[model samples]
Target chain A: MAFATIRDVAQKAGVSITAVSQILHGKGRFSDETKALVRKTVDELGYVPDSRAQGIRLSESRTVGLLVPDIRNPFFADLVSSMEEQLYEKGYSTLIGTSAEDVQRQDAFITTLLGQRIDGAIVVPEGADSPGIRSLIDRDLPLVFVDRTVEGLDTVPSVVSDPYPGIESAVDTLRQLGHRRVGFVAHSSLGSVNVNERETAFRAIAGELLGEDGAVVVDCDNSSRSRKDALMALLAEDATAMLCAYSPDAIALIGLLHDRGMDVGEDLSVVSFDDIDAFRLMSPQVAIISQQTADMGRQGVEMLLARIGAKRKRRAENRRIPTVFVQRGSVGVAPQAR
Target chain B: MAFATIRDVAQKAGVSITAVSQILHGKGRFSDETKALVRKTVDELGYVPDSRAQGIRLSESRTVGLLVPDIRNPFFADLVSSMEEQLYEKGYSTLIGTSAEDVQRQDAFITTLLGQRIDGAIVVPEGADSPGIRSLIDRDLPLVFVDRTVEGLDTVPSVVSDPYPGIESAVDTLRQLGHRRVGFVAHSSLGSVNVNERETAFRAIAGELLGEDGAVVVDCDNSSRSRKDALMALLAEDATAMLCAYSPDAIALIGLLHDRGMDVGEDLSVVSFDDIDAFRLMSPQVAIISQQTADMGRQGVEMLLARIGAKRKRRAENRRIPTVFVQRGSVGVAPQAR
Candidate 1:
């Protein structure tokens, strides 16, 4: 027997093929009874509608393109997982692209996704002003920015944590623990919103706590060797305590300290931002400024879905998920001499 | 001026639209000079070939479907990232779906990928026997299994780790350190090839070290809560040392030991499989049996690409990547009296 197609189901259900396609795609107008009857006919007929055929008819692939900075990073992994969960529940497939923190790669990914005719995109923009991303926005493609925001594009919805408050709280807590000269080790400059916000907050809090001179910001280029160098510079400043902007840098800092025979919590108090699975398992519990990555991912999907379902165009909204300070054994009281 | 299309590029390059399309898709017979000319024309004309149009013309989409058991797991995360990198270099985009360790969810993901008309699929099968996966195989889909292998399927190529030597080494090291009553805590049953290999090797090693009745295996369902129960059971065995089969389970084991005021290395030597990111950072280092996940992913892509490019059908091949045992502070000389 020949395999039954959507045409067969539609003919059996006595409805237009367009109606059958709509019901299958979960789009267009259809009443409950009609939908149920069509579904019943589809089941009874054993009609396996070819996805390619449906795509051709609807001109919609029902796929969303997801572009992340780096998938090796645990934070992106969690984000992608959460996004997939929410998007899957809503009947959308995800096409993922990793930029590897390269602007050229980001541009290439954008072009590839666009060429694939993805329904929309959720990109963690590579830079604050990526021209390729700007072109995507210009083309009126539905875009949702996650983690970081573009400087010029105020219309793209971004789901990110308000890093300033979290940084302030972290600095305040360290200061309260009698730490005056605190050092900051960040992976990059204030180019990205999150990094800039964190550095700005750290500087503000430092000024309030111990004047502007008290805060020392060391921007590490994020390479492992460079991070080690940055750690050495930060430690050389005689800073009693240090705040890490990300997990990899924090992990590297720990290794550097251990190599130099510096006790983590005793000799140098350290706090890392962005808690990952590995961090919780580490021996000397490093204090963490943990962002709700899973929550951000879940919320980002909801926002994207809302945009997809809206009748009229919606303005871009920046949703700030909260971050909490997880104080582990890594934070200690400053010594009397220091 | 109107937006440059494939037709414009063809006209500008003085080539037939079919030839230009073929060159763009990297299909059909075309000289390198002609291909370069078309590419140069495309660049100069700023031509953007519509992916929908191209997809319709060619039955094969330049997209591979990737179905992972869980993305939040760092192992899978790192694997997916590596696969994406390799596939991207080969000009194939990846559409990712997470099954969340559910067979039903995996089935759903497969069906969705089929609907999207993915060129091929690389799945990390969640169960030993998945009927949905079987159906895909029956349909003659190009499928490659990674990390885990499904039972009763002989035609699918798979990339996995040879866990025997690693497990044996871990057991031997533990025994050398005077751990006679050693226990094993696994997150999943001995159904998966990797898990089964580890279990079989551990059992063999245990029998050699402390007779047949000495080996204690606690199989825990892969959940955070269930892992705690498994840890408790393993601890109750009064084993001098415990070998955890996975990293997340090891993290939970450490927490459980700490909660009970049991020193990890001194009271009960703890060793885990999979040296995940945070393991080294943990207060007490957890000895780990680590797999080369990146290598597995890269190899999987290479094999899949070869299959895609093969002129004649090649027989399915199974490749085993190596694993390493990194002994840190977690595994030590078993307690003096235990």
Candidate 2:
């Protein structure tokens, strides 16, 4: 059986092909009588307009691409879920690609999305500046950055969390709880803006509370084993409490502490950023700087929609969402020197 | 800056517009020098090929639509992530829509995907014989079903889990633990193929072991409050142990049991399906019937790719991935005379 095209429907409905196309694409003007006739003919003939044909006629692909660092991370999952919800409401569909923190994979995904002629892209860049991403930007594609910001890029709309306040709050809480020698376990250096803000706030607060040499910062590669080693090194310095940069690293450190037979929040206090789902169900609750993942996702869709609507006119803007510190069982007074 | 059209590029490169278009679209053969000249001109002019024009000329959208029930569910997230991984490798972009388990929403998503002129679709239908899905099948659209199959839809390829052997193994394990009265709690009725298969297998095994009267089935709506009520009712019926049909239900039931001063695995044996991420980290590990979530995602992509490649020639087939029961601490003998 042959499928009815716009031409067939137009002939059946006794209208011009452009009229049928206009009605199907929801663009241009047509009489109510003609519209109803076209609609009726489309239904009766079971005509499903070829999307490829419509896309060609409109010069718009009507699709957006999203690149995430990882999907297994609940934070990213929640973000993607929220974004999908918002985008679905607006008649836009998202093509999500997980880079898994690999720069080459991220480049490959961007290239694929570009080749597909996606209307725009929202990416969580693997690092500060990606050459492929730069090329896409240079090609004048509409792009939005989410969660993490890429340095050396100008005037791209981005949605990120302010990590400073939360870090400062955690440090203040630690100081008030009589922690003098504090350590920090960071997965990476001050490359990511969020991480930099967190580190700056942590150091300033620690220095203000306990002189110049009171704070110890251990920078490790973003891996579970590296974090475990960093935590052990920090613990060896007689640092009574440690602040973890993120949830995955915090979880790994907790397991390491458990293996060493040291009780979390009792022998050594701990706090982490990013309150992942499993943390709530763990035996020893880890204090978390909760980035509003759902809000970030919702805002991302809003920002992208705004760009899509005003692509020809509007200038780019960066929006920062705030983070809150949730005090749980992982944080407490450091054990007194015996 | 004025955008360079195919005419401009062709004029500059001293070639026909059709030749330039062919080279840009990766079609029709061209000489090495001519191809290199056109490529250089396109790069110098920073010309972005209008996908709409290409679509009109070639009749291929280069897009695939994916419809999932819930993006929040880790199982679906894993499925989607893997599909994206494979599709990106094959130079196809995915447009994802979530139905949130609402049939109306599901229908709307299908209509939208069709409207966008997606080259093909992979859907996890909310239920069997949905009219919206049936319409796609009637149109002979390239389609594949994942996770759940719609009954009466014989012409679409489907990827689903085989629960019979998994349920049999789960029951056999309970039987070895001296459980005489075993209860099963599922999210829905026997209408869903996955739930129905597990329920049927459980009843057959229970009937053979402890007579027909010994088996109990509780149909709980996919909500925490409803699951709590259903679990309470099941526990009050003198059942020795219970099997939860899904992970979310298990998480809720375990928390409820703990709140009610009942000890899992000791006072009341419990087994759940879907070994979610948090389950492994939670203390007093929950016994789980683990589906190959990542495998499901990867295999679904392979099946969808095959359907896409053989759209004009292939017949429909149903592919089943096996499930395994991962024994943890949640199963044990019934408390003596309690």
Candidate 3:
């Protein structure tokens, strides 16, 4: 990196390289004035400790790593951007890694990141008890989980969005719109406690609000074709509204409905679980269960930084960010009500 | 970093640390079989050149870096993922960096990448005359420009989308729909040659398709508030259609129209310049001039790899991908035509 060299730093500080080095190493008989000048020049030049240098721990790597489940999902991508912005303000660069929701890839990524000399990490883990996660905890690395926390790794500080509030509100809103049967497009992946929690809440609220037969669950993998097929089947069964549990897949069902000559909000309403800016641009602005994603991201970074600085492990606790229902044009009156 | 140590490598290779060191340094009197065995073990261990070891240039870093204007842009994000998948097959990890459309940040990211011993780089530049880009070219680094190219860097290979065909198709589609006056909301950035090219194409096509005083251009400075004002002025002038030049700000104008009780596709027609998969989810499905972003990314990686292999500089050519117009329900008949 052509970030200012020590020699350049010395020249700018008006001191010998030896004096600068001595001051950096906390040695030699240098005046406080000389030290201050050297420090100022170093900061001005944005000179990081050379990664090539050995036996000298001049500085810890001022970088934090983040492992997200799926970078393609705008929800996670937006969250990462927020966390990155906060970490940048603290003078830390973010190294991002995406698991793509594959356990093998997630493990490989974790192994790869361990080679980068990152000071801390924030991960939306693939599975609660994945071997890679166990190894990470064993290493005592500074880590804060976000979005989803593993069952056994509860001791790690976590920031999660509770899905119950949003689910309850969505059910009530759909019921008021004269929808007696609302189908849910559920993510196929299991073993993720976050997904499981969302599924359970969706089932309970749907039954309570729309009757026992009102709750219809269609499961499909992350593939757009699979998700669309399941959704179509649910529609054939008289589902007036499709409440998509996953944000990335929300677009899939909408596109499918359009291709089939069905209009969203008018023919069939769609309430997406995770709200993002793009959803607002749609013709019938998508109603959503707004998870406080930005808040979760900010909290994750704050907790990670705290862990990085602490001499002892702090009491790990789950920081729950509540969700709210955002009504938009997507929640139109059902055909029965009309 | 918790990567395997040299001692671990020696053990796996069934050799002494000295023997491994000698073989790695090309100074050992070892049998060719032993050398091959050591190499095999090293590869299996996913080992990279030890950057910390002084005077040891063991292996070239098998990494390719990509710099995008904004990571939050799904267009760029999808392209990066595609390129990354391709590079991974060739045993190269992709290092991603974002300029966030800031020249200073772009330069800083470039400097940072230079320190990582990256084997090659693919960049969508901030401007034509960015000093950091010039320095990379001067150093004879293997580089490929994607999406946009800087004005004086004609010798650099670039993959750019040809906007003429898409513009022509869009104008023809609008004309068929009986739209006499079409107003465009264009991006505010001027230093970007890509934006300039699109603006030129849009003006020419709109003028040819719509009669005199039928084509209107309203400049927006990236703010939703100002963009809405400019769009309102265009609508006030009796424009039948509003075409957004930038995808990100497309929402602002659409949201404002919705708030004003004007329903898109019914009250007014609209078209978007760039299209992503998510756009299909929108109600009335946003019509767009589609740029083959994935193809551009795949081609960029191939061009970069080709550059990395050649000992001498090769001919630099612009690989232009054609664009197509994707129609949905957004286009409507003008009141006079109807």
Candidate 4:
């Protein structure tokens, strides 16, 4: 039940494998009679041309490789799903790989993509420094970075959320609600470019809205103890508003807050990044800094297609998808006067 | 900066393409000098041998194709992430494609997989009948179905959740809470084998525990209007306990109940399937008929690897991961007498 290879088709059709390969690819000079014989033998032997071999002979696989930091994250899952659907509509199949935020794993996927000879690639890079990303740029692969991009690689086109508008609006809203200071909580991972950018944006915005010492930022590991410690630090700082740079942290904080008999929107105000479905289902629907994931996915694919269509010309333009603040029930006035 | 092809290597080494290919693959007779020349030329030119071309020459790709129905669904997202991790540890790269519940998309992925000459495949079939599945079977491709199986293809090995244990326990617990009947809400899509099985199991279990009419099943489309209609129909039937066969429906139903000024756990007990992260973040921390998604992902990869290692010897065994009922605040005492 093995697949009939070109050699088998050639043997059955009384020709060389090179003739069969060239005739099937519509390259090289071959008589009409020879082409007919090869086609008949191919059907008779049930030969499905190995696309990889065909890609070698023709230099196009019509397949794109994509790398995401982590698919377990809902935002990434949604982004990959949307990009896959759009690529499919444009007659390209996607090869998806997840790095799980490991630089080595990202390199491995990059090597795999190169070995597969994909037409182009879309990636959420692991961080600011990625040898794999540098290699892709060095090799001149038609590439687009989405969600996150390597720092100093401005020559590569990327689509990332601008964080400024969302952070500004959120800080302004909290300030208007009588909060003098806001606390920010996020994962302590230093390799994430987006999270670092988000935290920096919040700090600047809060400083402007509520003064120099208004931003209380805590970077914690994913352990429950660390999250609780972050919460305690916020309470000790007397910050009435809590901003989570990561959504999972927000969920964990809510659970911890509930355990301590604190109402989320009443005892302490809260807002977080990523509009995941869980936020809407929470008791007090949490406020969100929405990164337009669908637009990023669509525009990433569009940019990659344009680069591929332009024959690997590097596009130095970096596109930004502006984030917006959506106020749900999770924001409330400060428990004490300013 | 394009990749150096076999032709490029052969030209630089002053040898034929076949000689270079055979030398790289360690096949066919060639002089040591010829092999060394090809090797040196490959390194000098930075030629990454096309893995697909090598797969044709030697029928192994060290790659597997995976097909899931939807990636945006957290359950599927988690499943894919876990499976990809496991496969990566086993020295294989995964090519993932989502059907999005469209048969055409599923077939397209299948075609792409076959063209790519994958070493094997693990698919959550789109439905009971798939011409693509039939083709894989006909070609004797190493295949394993996960989460769901095609209706009449028992010859292929599969890993699916056994719904009886979870459904029976859930229904029995509701009955103990003085619920006379339980309403089951699910998608009206008839194509899903898993959802249909879950519904059927609920019917059988509820009938045994609370009499024949005790099982009320309402299948609705995914629209909000339809979900609301299904919820209203469940209320009209006077069913005090609600069993959602799908997780998203449970989320929507809970939101609708909140809007209608009804407490989920107090007014109508609820239990749904899939222990997704959102379920834990819900106000009432949903009770779930856990499918053990992590176990399913691990076992599916183990089975596929076994089959792939066995070289496509058909294994007719269907493995089942038991489902367990987890009682949370969502499964409080039903508000009616028997």
In angstroms, give how far residue B296 of model 3 lies from its true place: 1.4
Collision pairs in model 3:
A1-B115, B128-B150
Between 2 and 3, whose DockQ is larger? 3
Give the per-residue lDDT digits (tens) of candidate 2, residues B193-304.
Answer: 6766777777776788778777888878755668777987887887878988766667667657755657678888888888676565444567888777777777777777
Q: Tell me the lDDT of model 3 at B319.
A: 92
Evaluated on the second chain alone, the candidates' TM-scores are 0.73, 0.73, 0.78, 0.78
Worst 10 residues of 1 chain A by lDDT: A50-59
What is the TM-score of chain A, computed separately for every candidate? 0.74, 0.73, 0.75, 0.79
Q: What DockQ, between 0 and 1, does each candidate earn?
A: 0.19, 0.15, 0.17, 0.26
Candidate 3 local lDDT, A1-338, one digit each (tens): 23357888889989998888888778899888999999898766644334342111233566677888765678887888789778877877676767778777676656545534467789998865776776567556788899987876789889999998988998898899899899887785745567667888999888888889998888877676787689778888899988887776777677677557677788998898877777776557789998878888999999999988888779997899988999898888899899
How many collisions between residues are there in candidate 2? Answer: 2
- Residue A204 accuracy (lDDT) in model 3: 88
Ranking by TM-score: 4, 1, 3, 2
DockQ for candidate 3: 0.17
CAPRI quality of model 4 = acceptable
| Tens-digit lDDT string for candidate 2 (A139-214) | 4667789998777675888999888777778878887888888998775643556666677778887898777877
Specify the highest-lDDT model's number. Answer: 4
* Candidate 4 structure quality by residue, lDDT tens digits, B298-326: 99999888888884366477999999999
RMSD of each: 16.5, 15.7, 16.0, 13.7
Ranked by DockQ from best down, the candidates are: 4, 1, 3, 2
What stretches of model 1 exceed 4 Å from their correct place? A1-60, A128-135, A176-181, A189-193, A210-241, A252-270, A282-286, A327-338, B1-58, B128-131, B173-183, B188-193, B209-242, B252-270, B280-287, B326-338
